[model samples]
Every structure is written in structure tokens, then in C-alpha cells.
Target: MGAKLSGGGGSKFHVEANSEINVTPFVDVMLVLLIIFMVAAPLATVSVEVKLPPAIAKPIANPPKPVYISLQKSGNVYVGNELSSLDTLGDDLKKAIGARNPDEERIFIRCDKGTRYAEFMKVMNKLQDNGFYSVALQGEDDAK
Candidate 1:
């Protein structure tokens, strides 16, 4: 056979750049990372046994129903929803508080925003005159 300088139809054989991405390796790497994280996740959260001391404190009793005093913008006073004038406020408060010690029981005061400071002080004076020293001011909760 005669020596050929180049292979026949060599121009027909050409190399082209592959535009498609090879995702098999990427999928393999991701699967390996997933397995690694799965294996390491449980080991990361190791809990230790804690020895706590015995609780010796006495159980607390149920709290008493709170007593509320409402002062209206109309200058009317209320003791636990019962309408009362400032003249009878002390007696009404005592009756509302029942046999509970006035010195220890807390009396909550809620008032209309339009109520005057003088009117509020009048209710306070009535409570103080009745020997009820534990008075708490009630306000609307803003958390809601």
C-alpha cells in the first residue's frame, strides 16, 4: 500500500466543546454531604444527666379574687361593680372585701381616662380612711 500523508477524510472528524453540564459528580457530592450531615446531626446534640436537688418548698395556695374599685368620669364610684357614692365608699369596700384583712388585701383601682385627678384622689382617700392600705392601680394591658 502507498504511504498516506494524512488519513482519508480527516477534516470530517472534529472536536466540539460540550455545552451540557456533567451533574453526576455534583449529585454524588451533594448526596455525600447529606449523609455526612445526617450522621453528624445526632452526635452534635449530646445531653448530659443533671442531678437536681429535692424541692422542699411548700405548695402555694390558690390566690384570692382581686377586689376592683372603678371610678367613673361622672364622679360615681364603684366597689366590685356595685355603684356607691364617695360618702359610702369605705363601707362598700369593707363589705366587698368580706372578712379579709383590709391591711393585707390589695384593692385595685380602675378609672375612666376622663376622670379628674381630684375625683381619683377622693377614691384614694376613701380607701385610706377605710384602713385599706394595700391599694394597686389598675391599667389596661397593652400586650394585647
Candidate 2:
């Protein structure tokens, strides 16, 4: 006979050759879990389809052109139809927004899906720093 270590901080593993293997209970539990997942996986998901109305957006009657900026995966910025550098975007957007009347329009930001979180936050911070209060986020509506 040999001495064995039990459960403790300084314990080590020891085994007796006569120790019977008990895999029946383990297999039983695994089978139950497999069956449970098989039954629950389908019912766990509920699907519903929603319909949306198709209509053109009514543009603001009398307002200034909205100051818009986007952060692309490549980190390119767009003010209008032209691309801009990040270094000058903040100043340029500030000046563009300032040129408009107070009640004319607001700034809008469009972020691409692949854009990094830090980059998006930096763009938002720049917009805020440029004194843009009414900032709108642009996104596509789910065509449900």
C-alpha cells in the first residue's frame, strides 16, 4: 500500500489501481443535455416579420445644408461629395456649421460598420469640440 495526497493547498494526486471507473452517470447526464438542447434550440427562437411604409422624406422647407461627416474604415472623411483629411475636418466642419443660421440646420454623422470604435469616438469628440450641439446620427432603416 502507498500513501496518497488529499484535497489541500499543498496536496498532490495519487490513485489506487482498484478504483472503479464510473462513466455511466457521466454519459447519462451528457445524453440528457444533448436532448435538452435539441428540443430547446428551435423553440428558443421566435420570429416575427414587420412591415414598414414606403414614403419620401419631407425635406426641411427653409434651412441650411446639413453639415455631415463620415468616418470610413480607411479613416477618410466626407464633408460633401469630396473627401477630406482628419487633421482639417474638425476646423472645416466648425467653420461650415458656423456659416449657417442658428435655426437653419444641424450636423449629421454617418459611421461605417467597419469603422473602429476609437475612431468613431474621436470623430464625435471633434464634432462636439467644434460646438455642434444638435448632432444627428445617420443610419439605414431595416427594410422590414
Candidate 3:
């Protein structure tokens, strides 16, 4: 007549912890972001259309030497190898322009690589204000 076994079924329910992360949602979110960027990438680029004049390759007979305006790294301005100050640049440039047809005159601006953009722009603005529209910027030729 020993102890009576407790009634009922012997089935036991065990609870297990899940440590694995669910990456399905994370992958879905990433794919959505990728698609959004792909759709917007091309729209973000901007382009400008310019109407340029027709080009004619011809050598001029006895072409006039272009006027050179050089800007040094130290912000000094030179008008044709002569050191000129900004205040007097207008008068000097005027005299130079007076010597030739303003319509046919082309002024070339040369600036040292180390020169500040603002300094270079000031020279351009001054020339433009003085009615010098045929201005050209001089750049070093690329070594092939």
C-alpha cells in the first residue's frame, strides 16, 4: 500500500528561449531604402544648355598681341609686365583699350595657381565694369 502516484498524465510542457534575431524586417527596410535612392538618383542631377557660336579655324594675318593682365599670388596686379595697383588699374586699362578698337580688343587674364579666387574675380569685375567684355582667361596647357 505504498504512496499512491499522483493522478493525471505524465506529459510535461517545456518553455525554450529563442536567442536568434529576426533579420527579415531589417532586410526589407534596407531594400526599400535602396529602391528609394535608385529612383531619386537620376532626378538629382542638373544640366545646363548653352548656345555657343560656330567655330572657324583660320589664322589671322598680323594679329595683334593680346593684352595680358597677370595676378600674382601676393595679390599684385600687372598690366603688360608693369606693376599696376587696383585703384589705378581702371585708368591704365582704359589707356590700353583706347589704343585699339574696343570691339576688336581681347584682354587675357593670367593668375598664379596660388592666387585667391576673390582676387581674380575682382580683376574680372573691374574690367567688365569698364566695358571690357571680350575677356579671356589664360590657363596652363595640360602636359600630355
Candidate 3: pairs in clash? none
Model 3 shows how many backbone clashes? 0
TM-score of 1: 0.59
* lDDT by residue for model 1 (60-124), tens: 99988999999889988888879999899888888887888888999899999999999999888
TM-score of 2: 0.50
Candidate 2 or 3, higher lDDT?
3
After TM-score superposition, the amount by which residue 27's alpha carbon in candidate 2 deviates from its true location, in angstroms, is 76
- lDDT of each candidate versus the true structure: 0.86, 0.73, 0.83
lDDT of 3 by residue, 61-125 (tens): 89777788999999999999888988888778767666777666899999999999999889988
* Top TM-score hit: 1
Model 2 clash pairs are none
Off by over 4 Å in 2: 1-61, 101-105
Clashes of each: 0, 0, 0
